[model samples]
Target: MKDTIKYVGLDVSKEKIAVAIAEEGREEPRYYGLIPHTTEAIKKLLKKLGEPSALRVCYEAGPTGYPLYRLLLSLGVHCDVIAPSLIPKRPGERIKTDRRDSIRLAHLYRAGELTSIYVPTPEDEALRDLVRAREDAKEDELRLNIA
Candidate 1:
């Protein structure tokens, strides 16, 4: 519905993704569940979240990179990659876990308290990856030469 927006937060890691969700006019967000970290799993997650048009997803920028953002964009869903350092936290809030993080993300996202990082196009990401690979290769060569 045009009058409401659903906020989805994902705590993404190497093996699984922790999902949380908050709907418009709700005081608390809900922890959806954990899902595998794969394209197919993400597809299933999207399906469980209902219509994409009413959903806006956000996740911290971590080791997963921009692939998830790209996937959501391609699926016609709005998504944001937030800088981890920029996320807000309450005073003395030291407890950290995947589920809690996801819940906080969803709540903050719905409250407009999170900042989104710029998303790179596929071509730009590919170019950057190639450059990084070349740098790694050079480092390996330097190590072998020294040895």
Candidate 2:
């Protein structure tokens, strides 16, 4: 049997996520509509995608944080957070939209043109949060001293 891999690309937003799925060696990708950016919506998406072993998912890293990545990892889906700038742009591809972006990502990922960003573990996240909070507290203290 030939190796089959499904590539799922997601354009994540604050309120919703646009998804596209493409099987390796396939020319056309299937588009999944905008889904709410909530835990329930993500779970529903996983259900629709079926077994994790059958798909490899990817999304551009943005302000939404790593919640989706963490959630997908916990559920056994191999997920990657790709840097937006790492995706190649085709010249003369004038129109740009969520659907197009998602489709592009799917294609790039399938072609191995996407480079994934680093995803810190839970411990790393906690440490980073703690450091940021400490920095904010120190800034607040300095402001009070000047006042």
Candidate 3:
């Protein structure tokens, strides 16, 4: 009974999520296909992937936010919110697709080349949103001369 680690990479969008997995060793990572952006689908995928303790998940930080990361954490799985801009890129690699991105992420993450960002707390997010809204309102007021 050896403890094997599975590095899972997710390319997340509003409607669907593309998954890839890199198991321990030098083998190439494999695409795990796409799943709907829903709790049930995600839970089912995790169940099929195997034990939570063996899974290490990561996805780029975008408008999708940290809900998925929080969910994985709650499920006792190790998860990381990747900094997309910091991910290493190959020269002239212009062809981009969800499948390719997921595979690349899994490979890079397994090689310790990906940088993870801080996951803000729910309260911190709320306060940041509030400040942004106030700033927008002030800018709007100035533009319309409605001080």
Candidate 4:
């Protein structure tokens, strides 16, 4: 049998990340754990999972942002930044946590059941930053005049 690829999902936060791994053809995740949210930690996770080509990874888009995506790209690992709103959740399912979130992402990713957002190019992100800063400055100016 050919070597099976593994799917990894991450629930990223400011200081830590929850990771889940699902091997191909497996319906359940094979591993799950937490790691510090740092470039070095990400690299170490990639190393622990073995060949870059054999791993597919994903994480939801949120306040933590796309730095991880860029880092994974730099390492030649395909990583999807999923749109949180677009992910499917069972109706009436209310309890949620980092572990459950990552595990769900892993299962969904392996089953081809998640939607991803388009990642902006570096130049595009820079332009977006400028526009945001301008908007913030305008808001500040308006607040000062209102005072």
Candidate 5:
């Protein structure tokens, strides 16, 4: 089972995604650069990862929502969406870059320190979207009244 387990960490942004791959006992993790944060890009990434047998993928739950989580599930890759704040911070870690974030995610995941967020389904996502839209519309109305 040790040989079959592969850990992948993704640092996702609106434009690009930084990926890091690590396996148990591997000295250094492999870093992959900016992949577009689109469905097509996600598909391509899963393909590049090869067969997903016993592979675990993790990413921080950011503004991107759960599209990647759902996509990975469809591709048979076990994925975890974790809260960004739940991850442990390194002391004096001033450099907050995507590459470094990805590396840190990989290391933390390997160390079993990541806490996953609850992944919502398609229906749940639709409901959430509706609620958000309604809130936005209400806020707009308030702004208009103030104006």
Candidate 6:
């Protein structure tokens, strides 16, 4: 049998990550539960899910940043940093939870409805971080002088 692709959705946060998987075909996406937000946990999850070549993963872009995306890419997994605001929503569907988000992401991703954002190179990210830090420091200095 030909290998079936698995579209995996991850709801990532500072402490944990919620996971869901949508296998090829029309089956409803299933919640795969939560795991600690760490490299080891992610590697374990990938192993449990099957081959990296068969896994397409995604998560919303958030303050927790692109490290997870980078990690997945390094592991030979196709990963997307989804624009959260652009994720499709049903009318009046406001209830939000990590599990639900993961499931929705997986389903939408499988349907080719989710948009993947451009991920910057590590060097670019470092430069951006440096610029932001400098801006914050300047703001703090101004605020101190005003006090």
Each candidate: RMSD to true structure? Answer: 2.3, 2.2, 1.3, 1.7, 2.7, 1.7
Residue-level lDDT tens digits of model 2 in 36-109: 99989998888887778777999999899899999998889999999888778778887988998898888888
User: Alpha-carbon error at 66 in model 6, in Å?
Assistant: 1.0
Candidate 1 displacement at residue 101 in angstroms? 0.2
Residue 7 lDDT in model 3? 98
What total of clashing residue pairs does each candidate reach? 0, 0, 0, 0, 0, 0
- List of clashing residue pairs for candidate 5: none
> Which residue runs of candidate 4 sit more than 4 Å off their true CA positions?
142-147
Off by over 4 Å in 3: none
Q: What is the lDDT of residue 67 in candidate 6?
A: 90
For each candidate in the order shown, give its overall lDDT on alpha carbons. 0.92, 0.89, 0.96, 0.92, 0.85, 0.95
lDDT of 6 by residue, 8-79 (tens): 999999999999999999999999999999999999999999889999999999999889998999999999
Flag regions of model 6 displaced more than 4 Å. 137-147
User: Model 6 lDDT vs. the true structure?
Assistant: 0.95
Query: Where is model 5 poorest over a 10-residue stretch in terms of lDDT?
Result: 1-10
C-alpha lDDT (0 to 100) for residue 107 of candidate 1: 96
Per-residue lDDT tens digits for candidate 1, residues 1-147, read 353788999999989999999999866999999999999999988887778888999999988888889899889899999999999989999999999999999999999999998888889889999999999999999999999
The lDDT ranking, best first, is 3, 6, 1, 4, 2, 5
TM-score of every candidate: 0.86, 0.85, 0.96, 0.91, 0.82, 0.91
**Which candidate gets the maximum TM-score versus the true structure?**
3
> Can you write out model 4's per-residue Cα lDDT over 20-104, one digit (the tens) per residue?
9989886698547999999999999899888998889999999977888999999999999999999999999899999999999
TM-score of 2: 0.85
Whole-model lDDT, model 3:
0.96
Q: Which 10-residue span in candidate 4 carries the lowest summed lDDT?
A: 23-32
Clashing pairs in 3: none
TM for candidate 4 is 0.91
- Sequence-dependent TM-score of model 6: 0.91
